[model samples]
Target: MITHIQGRLVEKNPTDVVIDCNGVGYLLNISLHTFSQIPDEESLKLFAYLIVREDSHTLYGFSSVAEREIFKLLISVNGIGASTARTMLSSITPQQVKEAIAHEDVALIQSIKGIGAKTAARVILDLKDKVLKVYDLDENEVSVNKNNTNKDEALSALEVLGFSKKQSERVLDKLLSEQPDANVETLIKDALKKL
Candidate 1:
């Protein structure tokens, strides 16, 4: 039930951070996006979801409300867990997640670690209508129409997996860059080689 924590950052790692709040130190699991934005020398206030199980308790923190909401929705799917949801979120922006569901792009979901084709299809089938209901498609939204936005999404997914953006862009550009016509599978294979 802990909604948030505000305190000095006592420690940090790839997946978690320790915050000193009123003399108590709280450990919170966070996404890389949150980690990249947090300043190492300053205190931080993070929105958190406290999860308790038979053997342990964990706190997951998010940098934005949209990300947290998306996480909640993701975990509500029948077979998805918090770790899967976190990995999905880490691999794509919240907006991209919403869009994938909206577009029913099972291949994009399957590109992430731990999601098989069947599970990815289930996710698309289960959440498609629901996600479209809440997503606000703006007129100026940068349409991810790189011939195959799904492959572009895979590149974005690699970036979320900790590859540098420059590297990802370069790879994607190389694979899809030169073509009167290039298929998604070919681009994906080429991109993976770059990785």
Candidate 2:
């Protein structure tokens, strides 16, 4: 297993990079996230994962170990391939992917270019627990981050009182921005006035 490569950066591109270690040059496939993180310097180091098949060996590199771990987990899914995993990583940040899975946000996952509803659901179903466990994320915390627990509570209250979700969100966003420490009561009150 080519765990990592550290050497002179011989070439850099959006989808791949060539690193020269000693006299050998190694080509590593990479996602756009990794591409952006690659520094414009002579020396480079990248955590790597090697996929060996009967016909060939391919190496994928990541800017951080976290990204690499996420990549490995994604590729472990039944229907997701290395290329698909790379595409998912490139389409969104690793943190976003983790949050989406933890929250079971099928729509967010399906929004990716090549993912379908079934695949998105399968991803959430198969990986939700694993992601939460591996990332040390609590489901409650994930939901809180996704909707901001206080804001969500306020929004729900407003909606029950006949306020539109869009309107409620707008007002709540503004209130939260101005006073981030605002509690649910304050958000609901301010939002009612605005609405």
The number of the candidate with the highest TM-score is 2
Please state every model's RMSD to the true fold in angstroms. 7.1, 6.1
lDDT score of residue 112 within candidate 2: 86
Candidate 1 stretches greater than 4 Å from native: 137-195
lDDT of 2: 0.87
Listed in order, each prediction's TM-score against the native is: 0.69, 0.74
Candidate 1 per-residue lDDT over residues 7-113, each given as its tens digit? 99999887889999999999988877677767777689888997889998989998787888888888888899899998888887777888877666565787789
Q: For residues 70-112, what per-residue lDDT tens digits would candidate 2 score against the true structure?
A: 9998898889999999999889988888888897766567768
Error of 1 at 84 (Å): 0.9
Alpha carbon lDDT of each predicted model? 0.77, 0.87
Clashes found in each candidate (C-alpha, N, C closer than 3 A) = 0, 0
